[model samples]
Target: MALKWVKDNALNLGGSPDHITIFGEGAGAASVGFHMLSPMSRDLFTNAIMQSSSPTSYWAVKGTQETSARVATLAASVSCPVSLGDALLPCLRAVDAKLLTDQQWTLVNRWFDVPIGPIVDGAFLPSHPEDMLKAGDIKKTNVLMGVNLNEGIFWIYSFAANMPLDKEGATDKEQFRNIVLAIADNNATLQTELLKVYSKEFADAQKRRIRILDAASGDSLFKCSVVDFARQYTELGGRVHLYSFEEKLTSNPWPGWMGVLQGYEIEVVFGLPLNNGSTNTQAEKDLTKEVMGLWTSFAKTGTPEFGEVEWPMYSTETEDYVKIRTKGTTVARRLRSHACAVWAGHQFP
Candidate 1:
């Protein structure tokens, strides 16, 4: 319908139908990636930009069983029949919108699990998105994809109260392994391997456990998925541009230890005011212009060109991407490659 409207009335609305760019951040980015895969969405857009999320990310999808379980929970919360008999759609629609939303949030706010997400219904998405990308089923549109430096820090800190951080703000081996296991779908073997990697690398006292786990979470849940998708998509002959936002956040309202947590790039990318409610700094302004320039340039053309760095098309050989920072941006490769390798076949839940 969106494409139909654009085709019929874009010119009348003073927009070019042929130049549409589907842009999304986080979950919306996952949506854009799906559109890239769907045959129905082919040729609907000429370009796509996905930030802070990827089709390969675990949180981007859920099995049908889990999705159905959440639906049953929601129905029970609203005092509707779980079976719904012949009134399934009506029963759901009859629940108060606010009540349904509150119930959904309650289910979603739990640590180590996502209560809801898109599922593979075997039509639009016939198989796992990872499989589709590897099969080269996605539309051959220009693509831009990336994640923040510390994407999982926000989740770890947000759920700190429920997590097993000790008194001095550290976690023991048991607590750390259990946390990883919860996300890994209770796969003990995978959690054991992850523990070995993180423990060997950050073999200090418990004091540094929080920081160590933060990077582990980011790599397992975000960064490695980004690498896998970029590599696989490129292998299938897709033109891809990758990035990692590593600007040490200066005006963060949270503790300094939060690093450059997830979604920080949205404000920077869209030119919004900084977290301190000030955008007067010349450096911030320059960084904002550079990000927007690259994005808009990709929308108009099919490539990103910003500052002295000409963002290269992603390939398995270089595996390079533009790293955004306040000082300057440069090309980097294989972020946390060692930790990412431990998570190669262990993505679960």
Candidate 2:
């Protein structure tokens, strides 16, 4: 769709890249991850960067048929589920502008029911992207994979900002809590399992429990899948570079700790920069230069490096990845191990 949109409307400004890069941030990164492994998307791009995303390695639905059924109703109501035969999608798009203005926050979670998404029909998106990735069917795309620290807290907080927390209505704080609760509730099993894991680390206070849950879920959902993506790519003799984003976070209303919360790099990526105010002045400049070297190199050469140090590809055997932080970048052990362990243990088929 990304390329097609460009093509369909005469976006062939200069024609395709001899090595076009298709990548995304968050779920958008999942699209990049899929492109890395998909035969359909192969010729479209030769390089991929999957930032802060890992497809369904974080959480898998038990009954997508039921989920699809629910989505189909919405699609039918809007005369959506567009295809060559289906003209009603245009009507739905007309409703889209209105829906954007009038739709409830809850509807955002119902994005699956909408026509535009990763379809499970086994046609376009055939299987889980990770499945194809691990089986090593993915194309040879130099890949970038990693997650932002505290990636989930803000997203969960933002998503839950409209819930009717007190029955009468939503206060700002209450709404935020509601979003957190709703998400935690939706993935109750994962939440419950995480609490069990984190209890070993921070054993008291619901706040601490929630924080721990955020960390674990952040790992399992986004972080691990990235590592897994690199693992598969490296297995295929493909080039891969992985990094963990850990720019010290800005101060919060709460007194003590600062944060590197979700999507913060979006502003940075857009060249809109801010300081988290956590580290010293020198550390800040160093880290900025390091990250710039990475992404810019990846963008330009499909290889991320500063000078003599070329970014190494990740291999399950070698178990190495870059730790992107407020200090500088350094290779570390296999990333998101706990996340991989959790998912592997759960889906043992």
Candidate 3:
């Protein structure tokens, strides 16, 4: 309905937007990424700004039917005091969004982690988003996918605070290491590697490296689908414009000084001076203006250049993306890490 609405509206207005870019933050970005490949939305929006988030189709929450049944079965196994029946579950979608937010983030995690999704509900989202991307149905849209330099700093504070790298290191000889590794299905090798990456902070750190890991988390959680979309789309005659954000954030006098963390780019990308209690220094604002122009121009035209670099189409042959930073704007065919490359190789349902 969303894509059809856009296409129909654009057609009514005239031809589709030459650029037709989509803008979204957090889960909104995830939706935009998915919608790019969605059967209903492919050409509706041609360009996208997946700010601080991306397609997280790799993770799925347990569905209502399955989860409810499991909860019931588990309850029964424990001699559950509650009744186990169809009436037990009123269906999650029935709940109001406000109520869910007021209830806090566990529900959101359940939707993403417990249930494997966009969903296979047999209607709007009949199959997984990655399926659409893999089939090359998603290529009509170009993309400006990126994550903030401190994208995962919040997650680190939320989850990994008070823990040292060695503790976080799955390679550690500690039980805690084993526990964290078990979460990734006890892939000790991967866990050991993750410990090396997450637990160990190398001095060779580019400011964006940690963010890239969080971006990889976004990649694993949300970006894999779009990775497929970008790769397959270009391979099958579509275009994708990729970028990485390296905006500098002003540190405040808080206990811990966190920079442009998750969702912080929302203001910067749109060139809105945010209330981080810091002034948008002229240099920062200049960079902000540059990005906003590129983004909105792409939204209006399907290209991301606003008197910037020559916007290139992402092709299988030329696997590169324009790197967006305060220092410069250039087409970087590769990042130091193979995270995005590795992500593109996964199989989608």
Candidate 4:
């Protein structure tokens, strides 16, 4: 309906309806992807830009059953009458916004550990996203999507700060093991295999357990799923442009080793002068300009033409992408396929 309005009113506002692009980042990116997969929204948007998110992301995509449970929990938390069934929507609507929001956050943090995101509710999402994409339910829109290098660093940092470990390695070790077990359904064999792989990677680290868990969280939580979505979409003959945002901020925002933490692309993409209180360098400004141009041009046309490098459409054979960097932007191929393969064994939800 909103897209319809935009299409109808674009010409009056001196814009072309045919040039409409639906772009979003983070969970908003998930929304964009959701629209792409929705049968009702086919060709409503000419192009899409999804950064740091995709339909395959576990937390971003939820089941209707879980969504119902969450709704019940939120209602109960706010002292609403859950047994009313048909009357629940009106009851919830009448609750004070602040009270409802607080209760919802409390329930979300207590049980899920992650914020509530979009759910597959049969109508908007006819089936699981994997099924939808595999069965060719996605619009063949031009897509630009990618992830940050260390998207999970700040997540771990938050966990560490809130749940202070008694000893550096020992407490984190146990916690990491428990986390892996919880994620793997207490499967001893899977837990052991995951630990072994991570142990080998962080063999000489000062904080071995932290590094191991961070790697697992980042890859499993976002990167692998993103790669899977991109691969499936590309195989379906979509014009996909992938990228990796590798530019570290001049001054780190989050404390302790937040290597390209999630959403870092926002400032650079918008050509913001200050990044966490540090002034942008000339190189950073130039890179920002290039990024803005590529994104805007892709919205106008279903192609990204940036500088000397013509960013190629991602194919099953090449899996190519343009690497965004403050120093230099260049074409690079493949995501962390090896790490992704490791996560694939666990069959991440």
Question: Candidate 2 regions off by >4 Å?
Answer: 1-16, 57-68, 75-87, 100-116, 121-123, 159-193, 202-207, 249-258, 274-286, 307-311, 347-349
What is the C-alpha lDDT profile of model 2 across 1-349, one tens digit per residue? Answer: 7765543443356644554666678878876665555566666665777778755543332235644554555555555663334664565567776563344223334312223356445655567665665576667757777777676555443344553323222234444343334434445565455556655666555355346545655665566666766676677888877777777533223222325665666544533233454333565555566676677778667888775555676777877777776654677876657645655555411
RMSD each, Å: 3.1, 6.4, 5.9, 3.1
Which stretch of 10 consecutive residues in model 1 shows the poorest summed lDDT?
163-172
C-alpha local distance difference test of each model: 0.77, 0.58, 0.54, 0.76
**TM-score, prediction 3:** 0.70
Candidate 3 off by > 4 Å = 1-20, 43-46, 60-117, 161-185, 195-219, 222-228, 251-259, 274-278, 340-349
Runs off by more than 4 Å, candidate 1: 84-86, 105-110, 162-174, 200-207, 274-280, 347-349
The whole-model C-alpha lDDT of candidate 4 against the native structure comes to 0.76
* Candidate 1 residue-wise lDDT, 1-349, digit = tens: 7866776687898878888888888788888888888777756788889887777788788778878878888888888878737666698898888887778866663355566779998876778898888788998868898988878877775555565323444566777666677545577787778767877777556546666667778887777887788788788878899999887545556666567888888877777743456744768777878888889899888799887777888888878888898778998876567888878876464
lDDT: which is higher, 1 or 2? 1
Q: Write the per-residue lDDT of candidate 3 for residues 15-130, one digit (tens) a residue.
A: 66444566787678777766665555655665666764555445432234754544554344334333555644454335466753344333333212432234445454555555
Give per-residue lDDT, candidate 3, residue 97. Answer: 60
Clashes of each: 0, 6, 17, 0
**Best-first order by TM-score:** 4, 1, 2, 3
RMSD versus native structure for model 2:
6.4
